[model samples]
Target: MTPARQKLLIVTRHTPLPWEDGAGAYLHDLARYLATDGFRVHILWLAPHDRLRWKKIWRLPAPFARAVRLHLPGALRLGRRFVFLAVVWLPFKARALDRVRRALNTVGLAPPRRHPSPAPPAAAPLWASPPTPAELALVVRFFEKHRPDVVITNYAWLCPILDLPALRRTCTACLTHDIGWQRAALSAPGIAPEITRDGEAAWLRRAALLVAISETDAAELAALAPAARVVVAPKACETRAPFAETTSRSLLFVGSDNAFNARGLDWFLREVWPRLLREVPDVSLHVCGSIDRLVTLCPDGVAFHGPVPDLAPCYRQAALVIVPLLQSTGLNIKLVEAAACGRAIVTTPAALPGAPFLRDAVAVAATPGEFAAAIRHLLDQPAVRAATAARALAAVRARLAPATCYGPLAALLRANAVARHDVARDLRVLHASGAHPPQP
Candidate 1:
């Protein structure tokens, strides 16, 4: 007899083709691992018409570079400046303005786009910036046809249960990257309640399992959807990647243009960055990312390298990695990447949680003054910086290994409906055949 094939349909915000941003990288790694594990996989993601031509790029090394560029804030800072200039300088042609706005929206800036969004006549939309009916319908049909044994989606925004009702019957799992509704509520007031009502909250309640990257996040999910299954799926860094270090170094900060990251950078630049630059005049601050709202007009020593294929080189040369996040609810992947690169990290206590870093294990600082003072202190002491980097690397290796992080995820997912049915059927036959004897 032949063995049955195990099929999985992964519905994500972006197709898991290449490593781009956090969510895109998540899907990419999942698909690659699952495919290697002998599961038949179908990926569903949103891609612009322009990106369709480069579909093959997802399988190539170049896309990995694109992913880095997309996530880095420095590069994005430049783009925002141009957009700001366009908003002010460009003619107010409504149709042209709409096109520009849509294009900008797709870019995913930290701050909201300037132009008005095109929406059909309704009292209020389902989401803050809801997907179109056409987009949701396409997702529904794609999942239905695939008829996967397991259906995994990102979060409630892209995978509302009401929109894709068929997914309820399937073994559904969602990787809660961050509580979008929570972040919206925190960053943009009064927006969360509306988006949550449109089915985001209910979808979480119905999900077979919800995976949060941190304990802080899992707790938040519990508050929102009390009855749902939620698990903390910690984030990890890629341990092996090669690069060379340069002698002249500066403090490095990298993140995509999200309101959370932007807030962090704004604080750093406003409070911490100026002080650090003043102390170390020649020390260059390299801001590498796509979103450019904050990093534009960076000072003399501050060079904004829009985006790079590999951050390993930057990490190698960097004296310290700064994660100055004020408002966020999950593990910072950029910090993980820094650890994997063996760079000393200076971040607010809020940016890093449950890392065992505060008890002199790995992390430092809780305020801008302390953060700036720490960066300056580390720069003055080469030995301390080197030692800290070594310890940080060891901490990452021991705790944040990809295998260590994904192990819990795999176990939880395997216990879902599809895996349970498969296990039950096998056990039933074994019991019926009296293959097991009574224990003494």
Candidate 2:
């Protein structure tokens, strides 16, 4: 008889659909590729309280709507600040409420009223906190029913799942998108470096395998978790045909409302964009994605197209793509995507380390003046831009293709399963022989 297929469970912060950010996009590609590789895949994400339900609640009669809003969970009713208080403060201070409920029950003075479960919302946001007791119980029940062979946590913050009893016997992997502490430090200057580093190190130590999105990140994680198996698996993209030569002088910038993207774009607009406009009078910059909220100022010759569903039209209309990243960790997914789309790229050296092989295929500029010069040069020479784009397309296909990039990760997961089995067998032997297993 053929052996049963192994099950792979991915516990992530978000559902990898409607890919809005790099993390979501990476998870989507990974899930698709792993499914194609023949593993039965399942995703478990924290579903946040739904917002659309509230919108519908408002459509009811004023008295009913007021009642519904009053009875809604404080987080859903009140807003972000109240949500933070509910998730953080209320949990720690619930003992007093519990005492009150218990005293009322003892006196038989007030019976607890049962509230009907609200209808599910159309779309739920991802949960962004440590799992509560109720959520943890749900995950435990899921594991009991499904019995996954391998469990992969998508982010370092989600590493708390390793503490679950369901995962104790399973081969566990942590996919660190970047060094969390480093990214946190860069984004928030007030964060204590040592606290973040220690927290990250503790999380890394819990995983059987650690996967990094870049070589630099792998090295850093390996140093922190010397005992853990660390592997590099760069971001992958679907290969696309090269763009045809175009006279369009529009430049494209795509990113979400991330700290790095906001800071980089702010610098580019204030410093580099002015220089580019002066040099090339007709050149225009088209900014895409959910970046408009973070942008405080809009300059001339720049158009903001917030949260585009498709980027193909933007790529088709632009002569060149720019990634003026001043500070970033891990691989920039946009750079790889731009290369895959066959758009000529001009990015900073800081952004090019993840795809070092593409050094010759794209222009690298460090300073604002240098960035302006490269963009101007590409705009003036369509042939050079086309040639560079063609080279990028070839390089990305050869190196960053999904199959080629994810193959090692797939193999690593299999190897981890086998290793886990062997260790479990050895422990069973030790138990049968009345011998103690070695401790860490």
What is the clash tally of candidate 1?
13
* Model 1 weakest 10-residue run by lDDT: 67-76
The digit string of per-residue lDDT tens for model 2 on 327-429 reads 8888888998898988999999878776687889999999999999999888888788889998888988888888888888888887777677677788999
Local error of candidate 2 at residue 219 (angstroms): 0.8
* Candidate 2 total steric clashes: 0
TM-score against native, each model: 0.72, 0.78
Candidate 1 structure quality by residue, lDDT tens digits, 46-140: 43222333232222354332322121101113431212223334455767777777877789744354776687554423333445566567667
| Global local distance difference test of model 1 | 0.63
Instruction: Let me know the TM-score candidate 1 reaches against the reference structure.
Output: 0.72
Whole-model lDDT values for every prediction: 0.63, 0.77
Pull out the clashing pairs in model 2: none
- Highest-TM-score candidate: 2
- Give the C-alpha miss distance for residue 428 in model 1, angstroms: 17
